[model samples]
Target: MTTVTTNKSEPGTTTSSGADLHLQNISKRFVDFTAVDDLTLTVPSGTFFALLGPSGCGKTTTLRMIAGLEQPTSGSISIGGQDVTKLPSFQRQVNTVFQSYALFPHMSVLDNVAFGLKRKRVKDTLQRAKAALAMVELEHMASRKPTQLSGGQQQRVALARALVNRPAVLLLDEPLGALDMKLRRQMQVELKSIQTEVGLTFIHVTHDQEEAMTMADTVAVMNKGKIEQMGAPRDLYELPKTAFVANFLGKSNLMYGTVLEDLGDAVAVDASGHRLVMPKNRAVAHSGAAVVGVRPEKMRVMTLEAEYSPSANMLTGTVLDASFTGVSTEYLVDVPGIGTLATFSQNMGQAPAQRGETVRMTWEPEFSFGLDGNEKATEGKDAL
Candidate 1:
């Protein structure tokens, strides 16, 4: 796996046949509003990088700029060591596989894959197209028309079409958005494997968090045209840097609090009349107000009558709702001053707590994270 870096690469040092993609102080402004702010990023050669965000978050615009389909209103774009900001789409050595697939119904799969090569007057187009189809495991369907193929098969053909060109960079703009859940997941694995085998720099744009996390080596979460957070999937989910990331990437139970004490190794916060503690390294706000957060799955809920560990951060509340989803039971508990907090308990055959039942939720203090108190608590609520 090639490492994804935000730092600029040195001149004359090409990491792979595939080029590193860089955007320096990029911005796109429309007459009505600015679509992308001053954004800067570097995708290392041969890395599977994902630009993830909700709709209108400038991910697509960014992909378009990279593909030379749209020009940045300001800043520069470089692939490898060459600037391509003003180049036409065809001159950029970049190809895009869009969500719509854009296949011609009249053309056979082989013809579709060979179209680009044929347009470029390349010799041995048929042979290269067949090789591409084989790479996608659709060589047998080469002679079939796209209209006769399933959605997944067509998507693969679309991929094969783009791969046959051997572009320096491949941009995937929600390429699997149209596939059903099962096929989408299956394609995610296939796409990752194909990318690994080919060692091509891929920039994938998607709104689905699962899609981004499942396939990309690095994920950049965008909000309102700026990257809110960027990191490995596990790191971003475990230690979010902002309230928007914590809430949008997954479910986080956050409560407003004020920092009370800073122990050498930890920080204590008074949250809703309860003293909660988090590791010092995990605290973003050392003093004044803060937002204390924990993932639902990390919290353990039980009846108040049960014995509890004195060192754990504990909250007593009444169950507001309970939902059973086979593998785990999700409970919503209403704690005084803190509002409702969600908890997920694995179903170890014990019955789920009933609504209105008094319960105690406890978790290790180390599992908690602290964010700035000024951040909007619902900044990214229901974003997914």
Candidate 2:
């Protein structure tokens, strides 16, 4: 028989707000191909975390391991202090919302939600299903079949189905991938609000960086079967640990240069023929090759007619192209020494700089990051 348990805490008792999830040295292999390699991560209780990476980067594999749907070659999985590495998918205190809603076409919304309880032979299946529908604000659609519902409605049914189980954690695999841009944005806000209301631990997997940034309280950037970096969205964007994380998470303008001097808390780089000083968190290899990374938004374009000194990290270039996005203006500047730099400016009722106009680009020193290798620089140059 299906068992439903109500969660309760004493009225003034200090209730712990979150569940704790831990994965230790998780590794999975498919014959000669290793899908996940020595992956370890700790997700705090009640946190909405995302595993983000391109396809075949092992994000889905890691989620499966956590769900107990796939056995890891070596590792341990724990949820709320209980070891669940050897448990079956059904035995784990977790639920999953797959990409496809997987609703029954012929069944009413009520019957579709009652399916889980019915499979387990719960005594009050109908009552529980109604309550679940209410949780997702779909109780009024109880008699409607899956075909009668909108895409967002179907997704809510899936969420209601998963939440009805009251699992300690919820795993979602690209649940919004199928929706259109407008609907996707709407769902992002809805999902985040729902999660906050329920205070359930959620681990979502996706290749869309914006989705991850928008929905997750914490983000793990995965690459080549390994987690490159993990942190809050702002932290990862402002202080990226690696070049791959910087480039993959958002658009960045990478430059090739050699370190000219290490100025205690900052390092000066000779970018092509121009010298630029960047904030240094660690002592980078001085007097050697380096790569400087800067986000496109960090650059501001100034025409020759505009009044600005060349004291900052300034580069003169011709505007190769200008594209007007509603919220911002994007420019492609062809500079003599550093090649072409992609620049962006906010659209505050101002006209975009005209193409082929000579403009000066400047950025703050703190906005640039210095890395030792030339791989990212080479890749950026090749892309242009």
Candidate 3:
């Protein structure tokens, strides 16, 4: 995994407090089922880390474990250099924003924000709540009940409630999942902004790839209760560690083949009758069965009649269908030896190719990647 330094901090520089959160071999089981299996990770102070995976992949369970809401069957959790694994939820210096917003339907926004402080018998609770609401730009709505507010406003209230506590770390579980696409995007930006302003460590759990890419300084892609890969958004997207990471994070066109030769920096793969050259990352080696994964945007369309260089990774195929999506065009191409492949082209005002038109598809050698050993041995089909 690569370490990324955001504008909020210098490279290799720790947060002001130097507080590090660690989850050491954390595991949780319910009777016969293991919700989280030996999960381990370290979230640097002030870093926006995302726990991303599909449902039942143990992301939420891991979050609950960190928040002290659920006790781990084994392992330990430490926050700010203190072992808080056995501590109750309130005893730990952490706050959570649930998906439901969990606002008091009857209490006004100001009262709801102040509830946590009041329960703790904190002095000047109203003043603290007003300041929190002001930070969220909702001070004007302090007197309004949750029922009188919109979805976005209610979400802000929830954020204010959590932020008012001034926890060292914040846990958000699909906080924007309740909003529509447009609203979700808006909230994503707002959440990032707030996190930057507060400079608190954020551990967000979500299955949305776009959401993770847009907001997180680092993304940990999980599968089957394990971290498949973890890195910066661009690194994970451009250079995936495994086939599961590649297909899960974005759409990909996979071609099965056997490695014909390894050239240190590049490897040759025999795709049925075609020989395709691909980049040889550390995980990929020579002379073995492998799969070539390419993103749709990396492929370019060419007519069968057009001459192509023998060095290029090209395949003859017929366009089975095409879909125009304003920004890009999607095509299903059927080749004799490769079966069907999905290709996409940016809409640059060019005329769309009609169905039944024979074309040659090509992509750069760097744009293609050979699968690692783990992916080659897995019998399950690719996710995309």
Among these predictions, the greatest lDDT belongs to 1
> Model 2 over residues 107-154: C-alpha lDDT tens digits?
999999898889889999999999989988999999999999999899
Once fitted onto the true fold, the runs of candidate 2 whose alpha carbons sit more than 4 angstroms away are 1-18, 282-287, 309-311, 349-351, 378-384
State the lDDT at 220 in candidate 2. 84
What would the per-residue lDDT of candidate 1 be over residues 129-215, giving only the tens digit for each residue? 999999999999999999999999999999999999999899999999999999999999999888878878899999999999999
Error of 1 at 68 (Å): 0.8
Q: Candidates' lDDT values, in order? A: 0.90, 0.82, 0.83
Query: Once superposed on the true structure, which residue ranges of model 1 sit more than 4 Å away at CA?
Result: 1-16
Per-model tally of clashing residue pairs: 0, 2, 0
Query: Of the candidates numbered 1 and 3, which has the greater TM-score value?
Result: 1
Model 3, residue 164: displacement in angstroms?
0.5
lDDT value for candidate 3?
Answer: 0.83
